[model samples]
Structures are given as C-alpha cells and as structure tokens.
Target: MSGRIAHLADVRGGYALEADAVVVGSGAGGAMAAANLARAGMDVVVVEAGPQVRPDDMTRDGPAFLSKYYWEGGLRMLLGSGAYPTMSGRCLGGSTVVNSAIFFRLPDWVRQAWIDEAGLSGLAGPELDAAYDRIFTRLKVAPTPMHVMGRKNLVTRDVLDRVGVPNKPLPRAVDGCIGSGDCLTGCRQGAKQSVDRSVLPEAVDHGARVMTCSQVERILFEDGRAVGVEGDVVDLDGWQKVGRFSVRAPRVFLAAGALHTPVLMQRSGVRLGGRVGGTFAAHISGLALGILPDDVRPWEGATQGWGGFSPEVQGLKFEALWGPTALIAAEWGGLGRDLSQMLQDVRRAAMVVMVYRAKTKGSVRATRSGMPDARLWIPPEEIHVVARQVHKLTAAFLDMGAEYVFTGVKGLPDRIRTIDEASGLLSNRLRGRHMTMTANHVFCSCPMDARADHGVVDPEGRVHGVPGLWISDASVFPSPSAVNPQATVMALSDLISRRAADLSLLDA
Candidate 1:
C-alpha cells in the first residue's frame, strides 16, 4: 500500500543474507562507517528505514515535505508533564538531510569532559583534531558569507553587539550557497551538503550497497556471535509489508541515531550491558523571532544561521535563524488586518536563536506504530528564566531596530516592543503549543566508555555485551554536544569503522 513493495506473509523470515558487514542507518555515522569499511574491501550493506530521498529530487517547498523530511510526516511529538512536539527527518539520509547544516566538531571542553568523566578513549587534542579536520573538509564547513546574511542575522548581530553578546558567523555544510535561504525547505540551490549528497554517495562509490525502505526488526545470532539480521522491508512509513528479507553480516553497525537505535535493541530484548537508552538527552533548544519593517527577503541566503554563539551567562547559546515564509506567516497569527499586513511583509522578518543547557529529564518510547516517540519536560521555572533571557535579547533586537519581538507565550515576563497593540503576538507566535517543534540534534542514547557497567558500547563502539555488534552515531555520545552533532557523529563513525575493520581482519 505504501510507495515501496513488501510482503507480510514472509515477514520474520529473513535469514541473514550475506554481507561483510551491515551498517544500519545511512546518515552521517552509518554513511561514514559504511564507506570506510567498503573502502577497506568489506562488503557493507546499509539499511535505512526511510525511503531514499536523492539530492536531485528535493525542493524548497512541496507536498514531499510531510512524507520526506519529517518523521510520520512531521506528526511526532515529545510529551510528558510538560510536552513539546518534536519533528525529525525519516528519509534515507535521516535528520542530516533535513537539518540546519551548522557544522561543529565537538568542542574541546566537551570532548575532554567525555574522556575524563565518560571514560571515552582516543579523542585527545591531536587525535580529535585530525578527525575533525577530515570531517569538516568533507562537509565543506564554512561560515554563512556576508552576502548571504539575511536581515535576521544582520539585525541579531547588530543587536548582540550592542548588548555585548559578541556573536560570530556560524559554520555550515553547504557548497556554492547562493543565499537562497532554502536550506530548511531542502536547499533549492546547491547549498546544503547532507549525507545523501556527501558521505552516502562516497559509500556507494566505495562498493557499499544502500537499501532504502528497509527496517531491521531484530538481529539474527548464530551461537553466541552475531551472524546476520532479519526484518521486513516496508515503505518509508512503518506500515505492514507484503514480503520480507534478511541481511547477514559477520558484523553489524547500529547507527540508527539516538532515538531509534536503542528502540531497536529494546524491541529485540537484546540488552547490551543494560545501558541502552538509559541516559538520553540533547542540548535543549528554542527559537526567537523578530519582525522588521524593510523587506529582508526571508527566503534568501542560508535559512538556519549567520550569527553563532555568544558568551553565555545562563547556560544558553544564541544564533541567528529564519523560517519558511509559511512558518513565519503562521506564527504571525493575528485576528484580521494586521495579520494580513505582516504576511505581506514576510520579507521584512528578522530572527534570532536559543540553545539551552540540557539535563537528562528526557526519554524515548517506542510507539505501536513502530516509531520512537520522545518526551521532554520544560518546567514553568525553566520557561520563566528562558523567557526573561529572550525578552532581554528581544529588547536588544528592538534597540537595533526591530518592530516586533517573538518568544513563546508560556512565560511572558513582559511585553517590551513597539505597538502595544501587538502585545499578544509574542505569546501567540512563540508558544510551544504550536505544531512547530523539531529534533534534528540527537545525542547520548547508547554511550561508549571503558567499562560495560557505565556504557553500552566500548571505546571503539563495539557492544560490551555482544561481540561484533557496534554503535556509531549521536547515540554513542557520552554527553551531548553544545553545538551541532554532524561533525562529531562522522568522526566517531570514522574511528569506529576503521577499528572494527582492523578487528575483523585480525579475526580473519
């Protein structure tokens, strides 16, 4: 019934089809691992839950957005005592294809923290520096050019400077960006260099076979060793399939990212050191928007960031960002005429960013639909603090010429902007109640450490409980990265894949 062909009768029937290794997920981690292994002459088969969304086919705006970039067509949410809807990509390249390509290798502070506290080995200065260099060069990490700085970034920079925030241009994974600002809508120009166009292609070039629309339900073991895996191939959605298949490899790399990988292990009851999905978290993030008067062309240049982190006082980092005109217009939900005027002036929108210090009050639960659902608790106290911080930043933006200020409605400390008539807009526009929550940055699900008691996988990402089973993704982060996770994921996978290959050779 879905776009891909599958059979149910033959389900639960796959008997480890032969491959040198099976790499689960084709995002930054799996792609890099698969490519590296294949380059080492190993036959690597990559399994992806979402359908293959080629770089050539993506558009800035289309019906494809629901089915392509978003999980369950953007219907996923993070619910709990304090709930928030979170959207993530489900396509072949996973979230990497759809994320704002703010490239950041793990900062030295965080890397050292993992080594000292988390027991992860081999990521000291020179070691991590080389990996970082390789991954950044591959992704073409660079700052949003001055010409590409939209009004939002410009205004935010000016405002932040006035407030002594001292922001800088952020690095991103785009090539030949024409400042079309379609990075979120799918980079209409040849800007964003997601894994679909970068590492995955490299893997394919290195004799790796990537099978999209393939979901691995369970791993098949022979005796005490990992022999292969069995599962069904369904459409991108986790609908029932007609036929089934099994992929077999002596080694299996679980790189399904932070959310789904542990769910896969838990569903199979393959408890690895009893540490799967136990400690999951991500850097808490939110959005701040500013409305301007002149036409700023919201759809021009990179959509995510031009300005980067400023010195933080409350464990927060602020960047510059813009949304699709549709999202902006929707956020400008006014009663009648003012709404129309704002929508007409979509080009005049300026934006800023918010990042939070994450704590482990988060979790991922598998739903009946075979999808992993997330839940977050943003307390009223947290809201109050964040709101005050945002309000101050908004005042700064207004100081640098902003007509309107936008932060969520939950904790409105005060309305400080032009046109007291627009007092209600902040609460309305910045409400977490809106259907615009997202979760592109994922980390700290299956961690690596010196001991199995502390982490699920070893330093090389090999499962401590099961031999030949490994993890390589944001999931293996002992702690979350304050910045983007792409560079970190790639470098870790590169290290793990190389080591795994060496182990396989020795065993052979």
Candidate 2:
C-alpha cells in the first residue's frame, strides 16, 4: 500500500530501474510471484503492458471497457478453418482484471494427468495443497449466496433439477458482490478481489514496484542467462511508444499469459524447440437463449452463478450466462421490428452455455514485428460432439416451460418452438461452419514437461535451457484444465516464486 506504482502516462523522458528480479506481467501469475519474491526480501519490479485503472474508475459500459482493457482493442482474431475473436486482458492485473471471478482449482483428473503424462512431480501432495491454501486465503474464495443469485440463475438451477442433474453455486473470488452482472467488463463496485486489489497491492506493500504502461518487447540475455528486459513506455490511449525504458535484474520472470509469452520468447531469440507455441487447447463453448414465461431480468444476477455437468457428455459443463443488453441484441439475429421486439422483451431472456473439453490443437507464432499469430483447428468429430451437446441443452431449456429457444447457430432458424424440431435441426446439419466458437480458457502453449522436445519449461517453471529465466503463467499448464484456471495459475505461481526466492538467496 505504501510502495510505488508509476503511471507512465505522467512520466516523461527515458527511465531505468534496478531490481533483484524483473517480472514481465502483473496478472494472476506475475502479481503472485512478485509478492512472494518481495516478501523473501528481494527488490522486485513488475512491468505491465496496460494501464492501471482503479475499480472506482470501472464502468458497465462494455465497449469502453473493451477499448481500454482488452488486448488489441478486443479485435484479436485467431485463424484456421474459421476466424474467431479471442479475448485477453490488457491491464495492470492482466486477464484476471476482466475475467469472471470464478475460482476453480485444478481438477483431480487434470492434476493426475500432469503428474503421469507430463512428468510433473510434486503436483499432488502437500506441496501443492499448501500453495492452494495460501492463494485461497489471499483471494477470499467463496460461493455466491442464493440471495444474490437473482432470478436467472434460479431458472438454471430449476432446469438442471428437472433434468435430474446436480448443480451447486459457483465459487468466486469476491468479498461483497452485488450481482451487477458485469464481471466480464470488470467489477465496478470493488467487490471482486482481482489481483490488482489483492496480491499486487500486497506486493507493493512489501516493497515491489509496479510500472504501468511499460511493455517489454524483448528479454536481455548474457552468456545464456537472463539479466533484464527492455521495451518502450507507451501512452494509455493509443499505446503508442513515447519513450524507451529498461530494467536490470539478476533474474527475469515471464507471466504474460499463454497467447503472448511464447511470442515474447521468440522475439527475444530464445529457442524453446518445436513445442514452444504448439499444443494450444481451449474449452470451446456454445450458447442458447430461453424465453422465460415472465421478466426474470437475466442481467440482474451474478454473471455466472451456477453450473453442472451432464451425464451424456463426459467432460461437458453447463452454466447460466448473462451479458449486456447491447451484446444480447447483437446475438438476437433480427432487424427492424423483430429486433426491436426482442430488445423490448430482453428481460424475459435467459441464457445457458455448454463448454466442451475439445480435443483440437492449435499453435501461436511470433511475427517479424513481435506480434502473435494464432491458428486453431477444431476437428470434425469434436464439432459434432459440441453440436449434439448444444442440442441437448436447447431441448432441456424448451422442455422447462420456456416459450421458445434460440440456438446461436447461423444456418438454423432464429427460434425453435418444439423439442423435436430443435433435435432434428441440430442432428441433421450442425458443423463448424454453422456455429460460432469462442474460448476464454486457453492453455498448454508453453507447457512444462520433463521431455525437452515437448515442453519449454521444467516442473519448477524454470525455462529449460535459460538460467535465471522462469515462466509462471497458464502457459506452463501441461494440458487443458477443463475448467476455469485462475486459481491453478496462482497456485503454480506461488510454487515457482518460492523456488525463485530460494535461488536468489543462494546467489546473494
């Protein structure tokens, strides 16, 4: 609370900072690592690519938030068979600042898979448990109470109950949520405990300095060991470079998320072998709208309050979703009177989404100018499975007394009045071309594996061949987590920071 948070917007001329360690991000991973290192009596400097916008300055205006906090002004696209827009946070707190405050730990199966298949040791025992405990205590992870769940989440609970599926309240990293249904756009009430308000502040209190609007373009290595980083200080509006800055440290940590970390490494001339940017995976999702009998005001509740898994699909999860009126109107698929009518009845609209544990693989490459180019491929079999799962969800919504349902598929009718018709529509012709696929949970681009050819980092999160360089973000995930990964990323960062602290002590 008493340390430095330098805003480059007010800064002029070139600058330099010396620290024991330089952290290249300030999100879930970087903030946690910086806090731990500072607590271990190391001088830490955290360089963030985005501006530091306080919670009181946040708003419910979706477009304004996207333009200010989202990567590439919310226009980042992935290319392959089809083009898909990817959302990632570009702020002092990184993706955690703009994400739904869901806090899911690493699933048991995912933990076991990493241990067995990825050769990740010490991932399941008391070591990992202590890490989780520390992070959970810091973030105040808990479930949303029923009183704040609003009517929309209650409808989802009812549908799941009618269909004989079990559901529970989602755990969120919030303290005093008012259920404004604007978690995706950042919490305006300061109730959601993102890292910017939690660990990053703690890091500052412990003598860590945070540099906002400082983008690290490349890592500086000497004799095959990381020594520091260099980049430009950009303005908050256009992110245009205004001045050059540098940081010199004994160690460097990169927690720049899965999409951009590999690109940063490639631009820095670090060869992470063939697997640096390969093996990208995500939980592809589809959405459906249910026209309720009354005005439930879906946007009044917790953004995503309750969720459950179906017995039909092995790794599929269903959850209630709500968005802004403008976003909902765009998805309604009508014009003129029809669109106006739908917007007028928006209060009666509730949404349900299905997330499939996709088996597809993708890659991210660094361009000559240091930007990332992502290519994702969804297999035909996986597309069919998703289509079937979405059909089942739509049928359930229609059976639960909803007047009608709208599947967001392009070739399908705007609305389905009967369960049989929905089934036939999806079963007969649902392909990748018809459905729009987007993902928020991306992983395994720079995984941690014992095999040098398969991973970029070791189990301890140290970059394989680069001493004093470490990675402590979602990029270290050996595979898709099949759930929200903020908690997992934080826990792993705790472990990595502990290791880095010990190494720093020896060097001292």
> Best-fitting candidate, measured by TM-score?
2
Q: Which stretches of candidate 1 lie over 4 Å from their true place?
A: 1-16, 54-57, 236-242, 272-274, 329-332, 335-338, 378-385, 411-437, 503-508
Off by over 4 Å in 2: 424-429, 503-508
Query: Please, what are the lDDT tens digits per residue for candidate 2 over residues 109-149?
Result: 77899999888867866777778777777788888888789
Each prediction's TM-score versus the true structure: 0.87, 0.95
The 0-to-1 C-alpha lDDT of every candidate, in the order given, reads 0.68, 0.82
Clash count for each candidate, listed in order shown: 12, 0
lDDT of 2 at 272: 64
lDDT of 1 by residue, 351-438 (tens): 6767665553566666676577766654444444455456566667676676666654543422236534334433423433432234
What is candidate 2's local distance difference test score?
Answer: 0.82
User: After best superposition, candidate 1 residue 194: deviation in angstroms?
Assistant: 1.3
lDDT of candidate 1? 0.68
